[model samples]
Target: MTGHRLRHAVRRADLPAVAETRRLLRDHLRLWGVPAMVDTAELLTSELVTNALQHTTGGAVLVATLSPGPGPRLRVEVQDSVARRPRARVVALPEDHQGTSGRGLFLVETLADAWGVTAWDSGKVVWFELSDPRK
Candidate 1:
């Protein structure tokens, strides 16, 4: 499955979109024969999608691509029409961890092989890549 890609447009940050995103990703991962990564992929996708919906107005786009060769690396991106970038805040105190918000990017940074944000004319894209699960 070289050069395989999937893209979806989300109209709003509703529960349905979140469920749809997970379902699609899970299905594609299954098709790609990488069941091992389905959990991580789905969790990361939810985090990114939730962030896009919470921070920005309008809609967002979700993209997933599988590269060529034995590695077959996978990259996922969430694009939202918002200029506000994500930042990993410092939690100096133990109580700070109890906050209800501000931990998505931290999880991305911790789990993703590489992740970053790219700005476009209308919005920005937050993406993360996962290496070959077989490796």
Candidate 2:
């Protein structure tokens, strides 16, 4: 694996895993001069993992890498055991939304520089790329 690529799996019980992943992502982006999308990074990870926990029965693996991508796009891939492909829609934000949950894939679709899904062994990989937020 290239030094620019990093990946980790998070058990459903490991909330801290999400945060740490976000930090690593932010650091990577910062080093790349990709701009301060920490807020975006944080929210994006939250949504991806939340969906995995709620919709899938097993844990999720979050993979982040600054690999061969369209210019200025930072790639992110989240793999989960659920075979369902994600749908993107604009829905009214629920009034009772308590925590920063739901609407994970939607954000990925909207905010990423590019986003898509791919087939996995028993599931699928949800991926998104964000344009260089710095410039």
Among these predictions, the greatest TM-score belongs to: 1
Q: Please give the distance, in angstroms, between residue 130's alpha carbon in candidate 1 and its true position after superposition.
A: 0.2
The per-prediction tally of clashing pairs is 0, 2
Predicted candidate 2, C-alpha RMSD: 3.9
Q: What are the per-residue Cα lDDT tens digits for candidate 2 across 40-126?
A: 766787777666766776778888776543445556788888556555444655667666655566577677777777766677777
TM-score to true structure, per model = 0.88, 0.71
Best lDDT goes to which candidate? 1
Enumerate residue pairs that collide in model 1.
Answer: none
Q: List the candidate 1 regions with Cα displacement exceeding 4 Å.
A: 87-96
Residue 66 in candidate 2 has what lDDT?
67
lDDT of candidate model 2 versus the reference: 0.68
Model 2: lowest-lDDT 10 consecutive positions: 66-75
